[model samples]
Target: MSPQTHINFTANPPKLHYKPHINLTTNPPQPLYKPTSTSVQTYINLTTNPPQCHYKPTSTSLQTHINFITNPHQPYYKPTSMSLQTNINLTTNPHQPYYKPTSTSPQTHINLTTNPSQPYYKPTSTSLQTHLNLTTNPH
Candidate 1:
């Protein structure tokens, strides 16, 4: 009897192609040690503890008021056109309804007269005084 012949067959393994997934809409992952921008830090700080940094301006600068007005996160009182006119009248005459007329009317009147050179070129006087008082006294 002839010895049986042995045969072995082998097939090549399948090849796999790998491709990384990318998200076009999202930004690339930030580096672990990357420095944050000042604006970003300010925004984070503002969001984290908003009440702590109320940012009440001590000066009567129009730019400051404008900043307060423009800041979307902060709570600001945007005076109406009529209210603005009332403010003008109060500053010019000091005897007008005084907007929020109260027992403190005389004090507001004095502040308006004293700081006639305030920015915005008109009477932001009542609002300014009220803002200052509210920030300083907070009661």
Candidate 2:
């Protein structure tokens, strides 16, 4: 094999990636297992509002307590009282999207993933050929 990406790409998806516009660097990382944000969101257009994947890592003073009530109907668990307390780490970094998303609207191109192993790819109005191509190379 040529060790080159053998796909003949036109001007749409751009030549440098399997996907598009993913800024690997200058992006902050998220915590390992942070709780999902409880913010209100609709099925907003990604061009306006990008999907939230990473959580704010600066959760220095979070003490969450969860209480579970005993249910007689469910046989899976029989607990009198169960409470969970979680103390997330104090290290914090502001949340970052998958890639540098368009602060401006009409995002003509978008990257579908941040998975490092996959060949970089993006969906663009210009590049219909490489739109949403998720491949698994089980090396």
Put down candidate 2 lDDT per residue, 75-123, tens digits, no spaces. Answer: 2221121111121112211232333332221221222232344333221
TM-score of 1: 0.12
lDDT of 2: 0.21
Q: Candidate 1, 106: how far from true, in Å?
A: 6.6
Best by TM-score: 2
Candidate 1 residue pairs in backbone clash: none
For residues 4-51, could you state the per-residue lDDT of candidate 1 as single tens digits?
212121212311331211111101222222211111000000011122
Per-candidate alpha-carbon RMSD to the true structure: 32.0, 23.0
Error of 1 at 60 (Å): 27
